[model samples]
Target: MVLPTFVLSAALATSVAAYDTLLNFHGAPEVETRTIDDIHKAAVAEGGVVTLWHGGDEKTQQDALKEAFEKRFPGMTLNLTVDISKYIDGDIDRQLSQGNVYVDSVILQTLQDYPRWDQEGALLRYKPLDFDKIHPGFRDVWASWYAVVVFGWTNIWNTEKVSEGPVEYSDFLKPEYKDKLVFTYPNDDDAVLYAFDLAMQQNGYSWFENLLAQNPRWVRGTATPTTVMAQANNSYAVTFTGALGLAPTAPFNVSIPKNGFFVTWGQRAAILKDAPHKEGAKLLHNFLLSEEYQSPNNTGMWSVRKDIPAPAGFPELMDVNSTNPIDFERFMADRERVERLKLFFESKIGSAQGLSPLVDDL
Candidate 1:
C-alpha cells in the first residue's frame, strides 16, 4: 500500500532541507571543534530544549547517547523519556489533538500512527544524509519517517536449558515447548503485533493460529520473555534475534529463523511543526540518522544505513524485507479493522486488565 500523502510532503520537505541543514564551519579542524557541540550551544543560545518521547526502558542507553551527543554538541542537550507506547492507540492522537504537543520527537512503532500522523500534518520532513541508502520498506514512501534501527525476531532459548535452538518460528509449537514458550504481549507491543501480522500475511492465517494455539504465555514488556528464559523460567522464549538485544547481562543467546524472520524498526525520529525548539529538533533528527553517532560499535540497533556494518555481534536473518509503507488514506480509512485485530489479540493472548487500558482507548 502507498504511504499517506503527508509522507509525500514530508519527503519533499526532507529533500529541500539542505538549506535547512546548517553548519558554520570555516576552515580546517580547529582547537575545539565538534559540529554537534556547536549545534548544542546554538540551541541553548536560541532557548531551545530537545525532548524526545520513546518506548522501551532504555534509560542507560539514552542517557549515554545524550551525554555523547551533548559532548559533540556541547550546548545541546536531549531530555529523553520512555513514554507510554502509543503505537495502536489514541494517546498520541490526543496529544496532537488537545494541542498539548510538547514532545519534539519520538521513537514508537509506526504500524498505526504513521499514515494517520501524515494525514494530520503533524510531522516535519527532513531526510538525513545518505537517505537514499536505506532499504526500501523502512523508507517512509514520502520520507515523513526514516528508520534509525531495525531489530528482527528470533526464538531465544536458554543455552543451558536447551541444547539446540528452534530453527523456525513454527518450531515453538513442538510438544517439547508446549506451555513452556513465552513471548511479549502482542496486543501491547506494536513490534510483536507486526511480527504476528507478518506471520499471517507472509505465511498464512492458519500458521499464526497454530503458533498461538501452542499456548505461549504472553506478558508485558519486550524484554520480559528474554529475561524469563535467561533466568531459566522456561527452556525457550520468542524474542529478539539474540540475548544481547536488551538485557545483555542475562545468560542466553538468540537464534534467527532460517526460512523467514520478522524484522521491526524502533527509534524512528521526527519533529512536529509546533515543536518549541524546531532547530534543536532538527539537529537531533539529523544526528540520529548519522553514522558519526551510530558508529559500528553502537550498543543498540540495526542501522538503516546500508554503508554501516551491522553491530559487532548480531546474527544475520535469512529473510530481511522491511515493512512496506502503508497507505495513510487506506489505513486511517480502515482504522477499525486494525483496532479489531489489536483487541482480538488482547483477549486471546495478553492480560485483560493489563492490555484493556490500551485496547479500550484504541
Candidate 2:
C-alpha cells in the first residue's frame, strides 16, 4: 500500500512530536534509566560509529580515551579529532549553520559555546548514565551538555633550578627568579588569561609591570611553558594546564597558590542534535560518565562526578582555597569583557608568534 507524499510527511511529523512528548523540560530524571549494556546494544544496531571533535593542543591527548571507549565496547568505533578549542568551536558553528554537522560530539574548553548551541536547539537533550552524580555546576539542567573532565592552570617550577617554589603569583617577580620565568601568552588562551587576570586583580597592574622586568620567556600554548621548564630550559612557569597527574617528575613540581586564586573550568561536552549516529554518541557519553572512566586513576585529573575523589596528592576541588570552577564559566560567557582583557594583555605582551601547538601534526 502506497501512501500519498503529504500523508507520509504528516505521519513522520506526528512520530517526531510523539517522541518529543516523552522528554521533560524541567527537572526530569536526574539519572539515566538505561544501562551501558542497553545503550551499547542500541548503538551497535545503528552501525556503531562515533566521531568526536575533541579540543586539545595535540592529537595524542585523547588517545587513552579513544582506546578505553573502543575496548569497553568491542564492536564500537571512536573516530577522534583533536585541535585547539577556539578553532574547533568555529568549525562546529559553521557546520551547524550549513546544516552539515558531521561530528557526533565535542569536548571543548570553550564553555560559552555550549549554552549558545543549546539555545539554538542544536544539542541533544539526553542525559547520560549517572547524571545525578555529576557536579551541579558541571551539568546542564536540561541535559543538553555536561563536562566530563575538570582542567585547570597553576604555577610550576624546575625543582632542580629553584630551591624555593612560588607560593603566590607575586613570588615570580622576586629578584631571584629574574630571567628564570617562562609563561604562555595570557591573551592566547582564555583559561591562562583568566589566571593572569586574577593575579592582576589581586596584586594590581604594577605587579605585571614588575614581572615584565623579570624577563619571562613568552610561549603560545599553556603546555609549552611546562614543557620548556621540564626540559630545564627555565626555572619557573605558569599556566601548567591539563591533567595534574601528568605533572613532570624530578626536575619539575606543580605549586598551588596559597594567597591568591588559580583558574579551573570543566571541559564541556555535548552531542549534536543532527548527529549521524545518535545512538553511538549516547553510548560514548554514558561511557565517559561511567565509573571505569571517571576514576581518578584512569584520567589522571579531577572527575566531573562529585562521588569520585580527586587524583592522588591533589585536594578535592572544593578544598582548594584559591580556585573556583564556576567563575571561569561566567568569565567565558562575557565576550565583551573577555575581548577587552585579551586586547589589553596583547598590548602589554605583544602578539603570540610562531605556529600553534596543533599545527605540527596537521
Candidate 3:
C-alpha cells in the first residue's frame, strides 16, 4: 500500500508559485488510445501507487475496491481517503493550491466539481476501456469525468412501523406521517436537493411546503436516513441515494415512489493531470468501471454500463419511472437557482448541519 496517509489538515496553506505551475500540469501529453493491457503495463512500470480521495464512508465500498485491485494487479496499491465529498474537495483544493498533490485521482458525488476541474484543465482526458458502453445520460460530454454508478434519492421505510408505504412525495405530507419520518437535509445533499427540484417541477413547490409542515427530522449525511430508519426511532425516510440489490433483512426496506423519482449520477471519477502516479490512477479508474466491479453482485448501486444486467429483483434503468432524468449539465449550469433552493430549504428546515445519534462514524 502507498503508506496510507490523510491530507485533511486545514494548516496546508497555498503557495502562488506552486499553484501557478502545478495548476497547468497535465501528466504526459494526451494520446489517441491505449489498450487495457498497455495501460496495465505502463501502470506497473510507474511504481503502482494510486492515491484516491472520495466521498462517503469507505467501509464496504473502498474495502471491496482494495481487495479487487490487489487481486487483479498483484503489486498495485490503492490508498483511499474517504470522507464527505465537500471535505475531500476542500483538502484536495488546499493540496493543489500548495502544489502538494497527494491524490492521483478523485471520485466524488459532488457533480459540480467535475466540470469545474475540466474547465481548469486539471483532469486527464483518457476514455476508459468500455467508455462507449456507458448510458448516454451518465456520459460526460468532455470525457474528463464519467459516472461509475447510478444512484437514486427516494424513500425507505421501516417495515415494522409503516403498514403501507408512501406512493409519492406528497404522501409524506399526510397528517398521519407527520413527525414520523426522517430525511437527509435537502441543503446538505445536492442529489436530495435535485430530487426536490424535480418534485417541484412535477408536483410544484407545494410538495416541499407541505413536507416542511410535517416536520420530518433531518440528518446531514445521505446515508443517515437509512441508519435512522433502521433504528425504529423513525418510521420512514424520504431522502438519500437508495442502495440497490441488497436484500432487506431488517426493520428497514427501500422503496421508489411510483408517481415520480430522480437519480443522481454516481461518483464522477477522473485522473488528475499532474498526478504523480498517473498510470496507476488510470488503471484504478478503469478497474472501477470494469464489468467485475460494476456487477450487481459487487456494487449495491446500479451500474452505468449498459451491458450489465440489474440484479434479479432490482429494476433496470429503463424500467424505472424517472420523472426527471437529471441532465447534469443543466443541473450544474443552474448553480444560482440551486443556491436559492438551498437557502429556501434552510429557512424552513433550520440548519442543514443535522446529526443523527446512530451515525457516529461520519
- Count the clashes in each prediction: 9, 0, 1
When 2 and 3 are scored with TM-score, the better candidate is: 2
Stretches of candidate 1 off by over 4 Å are 1-38, 57-61, 87-92, 98-100, 130-137, 140-143, 200-215, 232-250, 311-334, 350-362
Query: What are the TM-scores, per candidate, against the unseen true structure?
Result: 0.71, 0.87, 0.81
Model 1, CA-based lDDT: 0.58
Taking the tens digit of each residue's C-alpha lDDT, what string does model 2 give over 28-78? Answer: 423467878998999999998999999887668889888989999989999
- Order of candidate numbers by TM-score, starting with the best: 2, 3, 1
Residue 327 of model 2, lDDT score: 83
Candidates 2 and 3: which is better by lDDT?
A: 2
- Looking at model 1, which ten-residue stretch has the lowest summed lDDT? 24-33
Pairs that collide, model 1: 36-72, 36-73, 37-72, 37-73, 37-74, 40-75, 40-76, 41-75, 242-254
RMSD of each: 9.4, 5.9, 8.3
* Candidate 3 residue runs with Cα over 4 Å from true position: 1-42, 57-61, 232-249, 313-315, 323-326, 354-359
Q: Indicate which candidate wins on lDDT.
A: 2
Model 3: lDDT to the true structure: 0.70
Over 4 Å off in model 2, which ranges? 1-31, 232-243, 246-248, 360-362
Candidate 3 colliding pairs, count: 1
Question: How does residue 263 of candidate 3 score in lDDT?
Answer: 57
